[model samples]
Target: MGKLTRRADFLAANGGFRAPTPGFVLLVRPRGDDDPAMRLGLTVSKKVGGAVVRNRMKRRFRELARLVLPEAGIAGADHVLIGRQGGIERPFEQLAADLRRAIAKVRK
Candidate 1:
């Protein structure tokens, strides 16, 4: 429902449960606060590519979050998608399936 913008937030989420897929890693961490909204964070490292590639990855991530998070995301938690080297080359449908599977794994 929202974006995770703080460095502390992203760092904290890094310490939580993670599900790794071929295209990316999904990290989920409960905020332990009153807010019930799910927050999203995205990171496409320089190792992935230059600015254009990273930005493209981010845009894809944002779209994925918008489409998938509402029903599948954990409320009151921060969900982070860390782009993998294969992410840029992967098909969007496959990436989406990967995300869904990852979230399901973390929820268990």
Candidate 2:
């Protein structure tokens, strides 16, 4: 999966399908013109914690994205993972499972 670097891309995904998981909220939107690659964005809001905590959560989210997206992510779509408080403390395996489930839900 490619990294979503543009602000507009994130905004577009925010307006798309949403699937809430125990560890995070997943947002997905189709790439209008058939770009075969899937893009990923991560959001760890200040409401979740202080800078240090938020960064940690982002790191975890990045890892999860790398591990899960290549195999399960939809082509021609953008996915944004919004981190919740639970993401910081959740087990890695469970977080990965949550992501897989969320992806499946959003695709439906």
Which candidate tops TM-score?
1
Error of 1 at 22 (Å): 0.8
Writing each residue's lDDT as its tens digit, candidate 1 over 4-56 gives 89999999999999999988999999889989999999998999999999999
The parts of candidate 2 lying over 4 Å away from their true place are none
Off by over 4 Å in 1: none
Task: Give the per-residue lDDT digits (tens) of candidate 2, residues 1-108.
Answer: 688899988998989999998789999999888788988899989999999999999899999888999999888999899998778889999999999998898878
* TM-scores of the models, in the order given: 0.97, 0.94
What lDDT score goes with residue 13 in model 1?
Answer: 96
CA lDDT of every candidate: 0.93, 0.90
What does candidate 2 score on TM? 0.94
Clashes per candidate (backbone, < 3 Å): 0, 0
Q: What is the lDDT of residue 108 in candidate 2?
A: 80
